[model samples]
Target chain A: MAQNPNRPISPHLQIYRWGPHMAVSIFHRATGFVMATAGMLTLLWWLASIAGGPESYATFQSYVVSGGEEATGMQVAINWFFRLLALGVTYSFFQHMFSGIRHLLMDLGAGYELKTVRTWSIAVYIAALTATALVAMLVAARFMGA
Target chain B: MGNGTKLGRVRGLGSAKHGGKHWLDQRLTAVGNLLLTTWLVLSLLWLPNFDYETVAAWLAQPSVAVPMILMLANIFWHVRLGLQVLIEDYVHDEGNKFATLTLLNFYVIGGAAFGIFMVAKHAFTGAPA
Candidate 1:
């Protein structure tokens, strides 16, 4: 194998300017990573709540406990912010899950044809959007009393 | 059947390889996690407050506790799978890659299980009525 000084490198995602679907896919992976980070954070919350006794438990709830020493009005507002954050994270988690299952299926030798792959990708995208919107509406309704 | 195939002289090439098995395990766990996460979201929605007794009671019941255990196990397994793929792609040094992957797999599983066990023990035994 003769070594060429000017060997052609394969084009990666960055080689070409990003398009809509490519950007969406990148965000999809990013959100999945974010969800994983959130999972670890939740594990921390669980451990602290379970380990630090009732005082720690109270501290965990302090975020949502309005007009209290542990939670001031501003803190309550922050907690509500987290509630909205939770809703977004929830939607991302599910949408990622749904799309991941499709990828898993493709990895298993299914959906290899270009037509089939594109069709499923579109389906997954649509499902993700619909699911995210539906979940956000449901969660927002809880706060709005609708 | 090809003469130039590398398998002819490979003395230790046996049925010990389990790549497909690992792939299947990862896929199955991924599916389990998806199902459990749905339930988890609904449970979180139903949670009225974050009091100790409430969380403890919810966790102590077998209905919820069992799913929680399964979810923990599967999530760690999926994490291991994702990390393994990442390490395989990025880590070029063979010996170091093997060591790091092995350590990472063990750490993820061990830490996750330990965290779950600690929480379960607290929920089952420590909370007051």
Candidate 2:
């Protein structure tokens, strides 16, 4: 187990053809990181606004949610950026959740077979996509006052 | 002086007995996050609105506030553990890796504390009128 500098490095992205399970595994880590950053920032801003009371909350809403009726062009651009970020975060949340479930099941000594692993991997993706779409639609409906 | 027994060398220099703890903690937080995040999504979806007032009102409820605090703590802990592994793997320079890990711990701890404090404030003081 001592260091062996002459030993060849293990096969990885360069040597292997990626498959569903590999993709899902990569995405699980990637999305987890993304959601963590986004969640931290949003939560901090939200908490600050709430602690500061209604006036501060209103100010935060104008910036983060509504963008106000008399929005400047720059403000509009920023609002669009936040909107896209919000959607991305929503997708990440679901993707990470499903992938986490897959990992939990694997940890429980299940889904070791190739077919079962692949099936679960694909299932995670599908669940994330479907849930993200539904949540996006609900958000849109809420915004449109439907 | 290279005279140590093989077992001594292996135990002293080889396996860092702490890895299993890190792995175990990561999985424990992962399970916590799975449940809490699901609850969060469902709660948000059930909300009447996403405006500041509506969200503030929701957080003011003791039921919501308690879980929200727990979720925030679990999330930050998990984030730190995951990011630590990522940094250790990719960051080659020992100095940089140490710096990055230290900064990461401070960031996650500080952010979690701020979040929980806010939740507690709202929970205790009630929603703004």
Model number with the top DockQ: 2
Candidate 2 lDDT by residue in tens digits, B29-110: 9989888878987898889877667888888988899999999999999999999988987775778888999999998999
Q: Candidate 1 has which clashing residue pairs, if any? A: none
Candidate 2 regions exceeding 4 Å error are: A1-15, B1-14
Pairs in steric clash, model 2: none
What would the per-residue lDDT of candidate 1 be over residues B13-129, giving only the tens digit for each residue? 666678888778877887888899889878967877555767777776778877877787777877777667767766657787989888877767776777678667765776556
**Cα displacement (Å) at residue B59, model 1:** 1.4
Candidate 2 - CAPRI tier?
medium
lDDT of 1 at A29: 65
TM-score winner = 2
Model 2, position A43: C-alpha lDDT score: 71
Clashes of each: 0, 0
Candidate 2 lDDT, A15-134, residue by residue in tens: 778899999988987898887787678878877788778888887777777668899888788778888888889888888888988888888899899999999999999999999999
Chain A accuracy as TM-score for every candidate:
0.65, 0.87
Model 2's chain B yields a TM-score of 0.87
